[model samples]
Every structure is written in C-alpha cells, then in structure tokens.
Target: MTVPAATEGTANRPAPRQNKRNKPTGVDILVLVLTIVGAIAIAFPFLLILINSFKSPADYNSTGPLSFPGSLYLDGIVNFWERVNFPEKLWNSIWISGTVAVFAVVISVLNAFAIGIGRIRGNTWVVLAFLLANLLPQEALLYPLYNMFKAVGLYNNPWSVVIIFTVIQSAFGTYLLASVFGTFPKEVLEAAALDGASRWTTLWRVIVPISRPTLSVLLIFFFIWTWNEFLIPLTFLVDNSTQTVPVAISVLQGDRLMDVTTTSASALLGVIPTLIFFLIFQRTLTRGITAGAVK
Candidate 1:
C-alpha cells in the first residue's frame, strides 16, 4: 500500500485533455483548396494586364500575356493620357458615375424603406415585376428606349446616359436591398412603434444605421456599373465627345504593338477607380451577398 502511494512525476502525469476545438473537416479543406484555385484563376488575367501596362511596345509584343515585362516604360502611359484626353474623360466619368450612384442609392433606399416597413402593399408582386423586367435581354429594349429618349430630345447628352443607367440598374438594386431588408428583425420595428416612434423616425434612426452593410453594397455596385458603362452611353450618346472610357478605349486602333500598349494602359487607368471602390466597401459587399444565403 505504501509503495502504491508513490507520487507521480511531471513527465509521468497524463497529458491534459485535448482542447475541444474541432479540426477542419475534409469538406473544409477541399473548399479552401478550390477557393484558392478559383481566386488565382480569376486574378491571373488582371495581373497580366497590369504587368503589360508597364511594358514597352516591343516587350509587350515579344512577351506572353502572362509574362512579366522586362522593364517599365512611361511611353505607353504617356500616349494613353495624351490621346484619350484622360483628364477630361476621367472628370466626366467621375461626375457621371457619382451622379448615377447618388440618384440610384437615394431612390433605392426610399424603395427599400417603403417595402421593408410594409408601407408598400403587394411588395412581392412589385419585386417579381422588377425581376421579370431584368430577365428580358437588353437588346430587346434598346430600340424602344432609344426611340423614347430621342423623342424626348435626350440624344447626345450625358444626362441621357445617366438617367438611363439609373433606371435600368434600379431593378437589381431594389431586389438586392429588399432581400437584405428581409433578414432584419421584425421585432425591432414593433418595439420602435411601441416606444411611440413614428415610421419615418424609426427608419432614419434605427433601420438605416443597421442597414449599412446592404446600402454600402448597393452604392459600390451602382458606382462601378455606371462608371464602366459603354454600350448604353454609346447607344445614347452618339457624339464622340460624350464617349465613356470603355468606348473611348475602343478607338485606339492600329496594327501595331504601340497601339496595343496604348489600349492596355488606357484600360488600366479606367479600372483603377473600380478597384479603389471595391477595396473601400469590400466588407459590406461580402456580407450583403451572404446575408440571405445563410441562416
């Protein structure tokens, strides 16, 4: 009995129970691998374009699209800026996109509030109508929209493009915000009402603050789409002076490496703001899309 009472040494002590944290499942590892591969696949093209933007014309031609340029050259950048009237175009695009985003967000927010608060009766039908409208191909509506815009004397005007993009994009934004709003707690609205808050007061003071993620998503999407828009602007604004960056880039034509370099540089400049916007609002963008997909 005395021998059996010997104390255990530190090394002889049983190991502490393993932490309860679960290891990554096989499915998780598979998903992680797929996500990495998919991300690299999508990013490679942009990486190539960015690298090529800095290359000399000769280096660009001799190198593969995926290859690194031998050295950076300002010639491509210089030509892109000079030929495209980059400053003017950039300023114009800023105004166009900014205005569109402002108007779209304003209108969409109002729409979302109306539906989300039950002010708009038959909201489901309204949402369905918008979905149906978007389902129809753009080509189907071009002639009709053009005829109407022309009839209204909006042709060759920047406003024509701005207004068109706002209206066309509203359908998707409305759907997006509506879905986001659906995930909101109904009890909060009831509690506000019980606290003697008016509908407008509750929305402004409570709902809007909580809805930041969704609103940020809408703002960024509308901004990028309007900023990079080409077809609508081209169709509406026939004059070269009103050409958007995408349409302007298309005019850089020549059967030479220099021309290609110029085009790539112009494209790089055009895409810079979109990158900035996404980087700024990326958190909301991810959360917004995932809100309804999960519990």
Candidate 2:
C-alpha cells in the first residue's frame, strides 16, 4: 500500500467540522431594536418638517403635524425662495464652506507636518494651546473678533466669517492630523528622503498623497460645520447678499411673522442642501474612514 506525501500528512488528521450558523441571541435582538428606535428618533424631526412643509398653514393648523396633506402645495416654497433670494444664499454657503474646507486642510497639513513629521521644539505646548483655544467659548471671543474684523474692515463681510472659521476649524484639524502624522510609517518617509526629495517635495509627493483619505474626511466636516454656523455668520454677514442658507432661513423667516407652513418649508429648504451635499460625498466619507482600518 502506498500514499502520496500530501495524502500521508493529512491521513492522521480528523475530518474538519462544518461551520454552524448561530441564531440571534437576546442581546443581538436588543441591539437591533435599539438601533431601529434610535434611527426613528433622529429622523422624526426631519420627517415632521417634510410633512408640514407642503401643507397649507390652514391645513396644518386643522389637522396637526401628523396628517398627510390632501394635495401638494408649493406656495410656501415659492414665496420663501423668492423672499430670501435663495439662490444667492445658496451660493454664499457654497463659497464660504468650500473656501474654509480648502484653506483649513492646507493650514492643518502644514502645522501637522511641522509638529509631527519635523518634530519641532515645544510642539507639545503648541498643540496644548490649540486644544485650549478650542475650549474657549465662541461668545468670549466674539467681542475681540468683532473688533479685530472691524479694525481690518472685514466686519459685516463674509470674509470675516471665512477667516474666523478657517482658523477655528484648522485648529481642530491640526490637533487631529498631527496625531495621525505622528504614527506615520517612518520607513516611507525615510525612503523619500533617500530619493533626494526636499521637505516641500516630500510633503506634496508623498505625505499628502498617503494622508489624502484623512484630509478628505476633514474637508467634508469643515464644509458642513461652516455651512451650519449661525452666530458668527449672523453677526458678520448681516446683509442679505452675503448671508448663508442657515442665516437666510432664520433671518428672513422672522419666526414671529412667518406662517407655520412657511417656517417648516424654510427649515426643510435649509436642510436639503446639507443633506444633498452629505449624500454626494458619503461614499468618499466612508472610504476615508475605512482606509486606515485596512492599510
């Protein structure tokens, strides 16, 4: 009797057991139930806004928030759009948010590269100072920032809000990115140096490419945060032309004077742009987050 070497190696081993499917346990069911409930809770307000936005004020008052509209009514949307010059507000939001996201990411990358990759002196203190800056109340800084902008003639300008939020967002971004850069693969950086790449060249050709996923995440967050900002934009962008979608919705609606339907329509309109932006970028957002886990 004879056997091949591979067969001989396996001859003494017992047969492998088949994998069993595990049924859901009590904990699994509980977690799923909680997740569903949480989603509904988060979505409830948006749902109400959507439902009521199309209702006439009279219909809304009569039927309450839960009732379906008998027919789609768009006067609230039309009036609100024309009243606020919604197109201009939308453009303002796009410009400010896009500019802030780009500028903040660049500033963060520079700061993080200096502190983390360059290993600059007193970096710990610098990072701590930035962290503390984040902790300071926006209200506390409001007075000084107002005076500073006024002195510079940036007051009542969108640029004022742009500059303020660019610095603010970059502080947090630097804090976050510095840590990521600290854990960067030293071998990769060393290889670039061996290739006679200068610091600037290495940053653009190596570090920036590898860190792009994280930068994408930061950019999207900055845009959304800048888009939703209320107080700073309200103070700085007082004029209708420079105001953002959020400011337009709040200021033009004049809550006291607005019909309930119009108010709902206004809120829904404000939410729609952010929601659409998120949806468009969601894939990139997800990819950026998961990139670290795999590589």
Q: Tell me the whole-model lDDT of each prediction, alpha carbons only.
A: 0.77, 0.91
Question: In model 1, what is the error at residue 279, expressed in angstroms?
Answer: 1.5
Put down candidate 2 lDDT per residue, 152-171, tens digits, no spaces.
Answer: 99998988999999999999
Off by over 4 Å in 2: 1-17, 293-295
For this target, which candidate reaches the highest TM-score against the unseen true structure?
2
Cα lDDT for residue 94, candidate 2: 95
For residues 1-295, could you state the per-residue lDDT of candidate 1 as single tens digits?
A: 4434346465578889977988999999999999999999998877877887888878867886667788878788898888768777777788888888878877777777777566488989888887787687777878988898889998888998888778777877777677667667889988999999998898788888877666777777788888877777768766657777776776554322455666678778888877887888787789976753564
How high is each candidate's TM-score?
0.82, 0.93
Worst window of 10 by summed lDDT in candidate 1: 251-260
lDDT of 2 at 225: 94
Error of 1 at 82 (Å): 0.7
Off by over 4 Å in 1: 1-16, 20-29, 63-66, 182-184, 254-258, 284-295
Model 2, poorest ten-residue lDDT window? 249-258
Name the top lDDT candidate.
2
